[model samples]
Target: MRIAIFGKQFDPAFDEYCLALFRHLSLTGAGICIYKPFYEFVSGIPSIKLNPDSVFKDHADLPECDMLFSIGGDGTFLDAVTIVRDRPIPIVGINSGRLGFLADVSKDELPSALNDIFEGHYKVRQLDLLKLDTHIPAFGELDFALNEFAVAKRDSSSMITIHANLNGDYLNSYWADGLIIATATGSTAYSLSVGGPIMHPASKNLIINPIAPHNLTVRPLVVPNDFDLTLRVESRGGSYLVSLDSRSCILEESIELKIRKADFSVSVIERNGKTFYSTLRSKLMWGADRRN
Candidate 1:
């Protein structure tokens, strides 16, 4: 079987496991291809020097394989999706950081993880993505966001006015730093940091979370998957910053963004031993309070 590797960075502290994992795969006789970004970051590690005709930035050059292994933290895993956007290959995260929600495997668990995987001990799950469309069609340059697409004020000085409408009906204009429209997969990410409720990956709900709203009554809104959100931003601080994971774009107030579920979804490699709620409890320290 063949497995491609993708990562943003490889930590020096985890070099041994990195090396071990590669060696283990070689011993297990799996063919490997490395992402160009990861190849530059961890060059000369005695790992197979796979040639990368394409880097993550170029997007078109990413090689295909049966499955892609993402090495590093959760951020790297998210970065992996941009490379594997709309592809059918299952992406698995091998964690090399603290409190990894997306990256599941710890360094110590590498060997057994591979054992289970090689022994057909894995589950391929489908994750729904929120795609932001400019609807301009010609500007294919900026379109989809696998995790989320957000528009926020650039500075802390002023509360930006974001007029939001649901399915063509006026909902409310949010006067806040910005708003986050997160997928169920992203509910625990930036959205959670700003008071959005954590949602299971399978939930058919989209979260419209306000970032530092000025009005106390403006709480995070959980809407239907069918809810079409229209966002119009008027920020005095600067042009609103729209982020698709790490990629950012600036938009004038005149531009309107329409968000809804995309036509496609991403496939993830998940195993049964690790449950989403358990990861939340372990990573976020949920219900960890102890009575002394």
Candidate 2:
């Protein structure tokens, strides 16, 4: 089996765990490749050997692999998605940061989790991604997001008006700081923080949640995933920010934006009876109330 590890910068404290993961994988006799920058950083540490031939600097240089290990927080997992870019490789996240809602695997569970993969005791689950259709083409070929595609006012002191439609039918004009079109996989992310409901990952639905709406009655709406939505934003600053997961870019006012489910879904590896429900209960403290 072939596996590649991808991540950004690392915290010094987590270096041992990272080294341990690589060492354990090496013992399995699987071919391994490390992201070039991470390879450089880890090479300086004592007793670490990273083959120069087994380094991938960018997505273009990354070889085909059975699995890709994302070794950071949820944001790094999202970055890994951009690297995969419609590829069928199953991704598993090894969380080394806080609030790992997406990157659920903890450092303590890394060894056992990897063993599950090598022993063929893991499940691959398909996750839907949201694709953005815009004339601007801000994100190049990596325009899809596993979490959400958002539009927000560029000015911190001002709000924006987003006119939205569902299949050419008027939805609503959102007067708020921003608007989020989040997938089921994203319900727990920025959407949740802005008063959106937590949705089951398998649910065939998309959520439209306003960020700090001027009107309190403007509530979040759930729509069928099949619907193609269009949005036009009016901002006082003459521009707005468009973000696909962690990648953001500026857009001019009145640039119409289109969003729909992507043609391909991302495959994520799940192991050790870690269901979405279990993650919710543990991550969100769903049933931890003292009165209960």
Candidate 3:
């Protein structure tokens, strides 16, 4: 099997696990194609020696592979999505630190996870994503986000007014710090922090969440993913910050913004015996209370 390795800088304590992962892959006779910068970082470790079949700097140079291994935290997993964009490669996220929704495989479970993967004991799940369109070509080809598309006031302390519409019909004017158009996969991200409800990953829904609204009556709203959303912002600074997952850009003017579900989806590998409910219980400490 051919594997593509994409990663970011990790703590020195994870060197041993990194080495072990590489050795396991080598033993499995998997052709390795690593990200160039990650290769440089790993090679710098005195205890490690890597001889990858190829190296890729970006999506343009990434070679064809059966799967891509994202080694880092959840942030790194998001970065991997940008590289794999619309591709069929299933991503396996290996967490180097605390477990995350995306990077669910912990270091202690690494060996078994790798074994399951090589033995073909896993399932591939498709994740939905949201696409953004603006009058100005701000995000370019990478205009989609697996999590959310957010608009926030920039360069001023004053709150921004976001006029929202659904399928060309006026919805509401939000007087708040910003607005978030989050997919079901993003309900746990920024939207959650601002009082949005957690949603099932498979739910075909989009979350319309406002950030710190001046009125207490404003609450997060869930809508069908099929609806098209339009937003216009009136900010004191005349500019706003727009972010798609981990990438962000400053929009100098309040151009009309449109959002819809992306045409394609991302494929993520889920090892056998690992369920989303189990992850929720473990991560959120659902049963940790002494009374429970």
Please state the error at residue 158 of candidate 3 in Å. 0.8
Candidate 2's displacement at residue 213, Å, is 0.9
- Candidate 2 lDDT by residue in tens digits, 51-70: 63388887798898999999
Error of 2 at 122 (Å): 1.1
- Measured against the true structure, the TM-scores of the candidates, in listed sequence, are 0.91, 0.95, 0.97
TM-score of 1: 0.91
Q: Which wins on TM-score, candidate 2 or candidate 3?
A: 3
Question: Against the true structure, candidate 3 has what lDDT?
Answer: 0.92
lDDT of 3 at 20: 93
* Model 2 bad stretches (over 4 Å): 289-292
Where does the lowest 10-residue lDDT sum fall in candidate 1? 49-58
| RMSD of each predicted structure | 2.7, 1.6, 1.1
Please write out the lDDT profile of model 1 over residues 1-292, one tens digit for every residue: 8888887666677888887877777787787777765777777665544443334444576566788888888788887877787879898899887778779888888888888888888889998877777745522644666566788887768889999999999999998888989888888889989988988998998889999899989998888877899988898754778887667877777788888888878898777687897788788778887861
lDDT, candidate 3, 1-292, per-residue tens? 9999999999998999999999999999999999999999999999999999999999999999999999999899999999999989999999998858888888888999999999999999999999998877899989999989999988557998999999999999999989999998888788988999989899999999999998889999999999999988888778889999999998865498999999999999998999888888987788899888
User: What are the lDDT figures for the candidates, one per model?
Assistant: 0.80, 0.89, 0.92
In candidate 2 the C-alpha lDDT for residue 62 amounts to 89
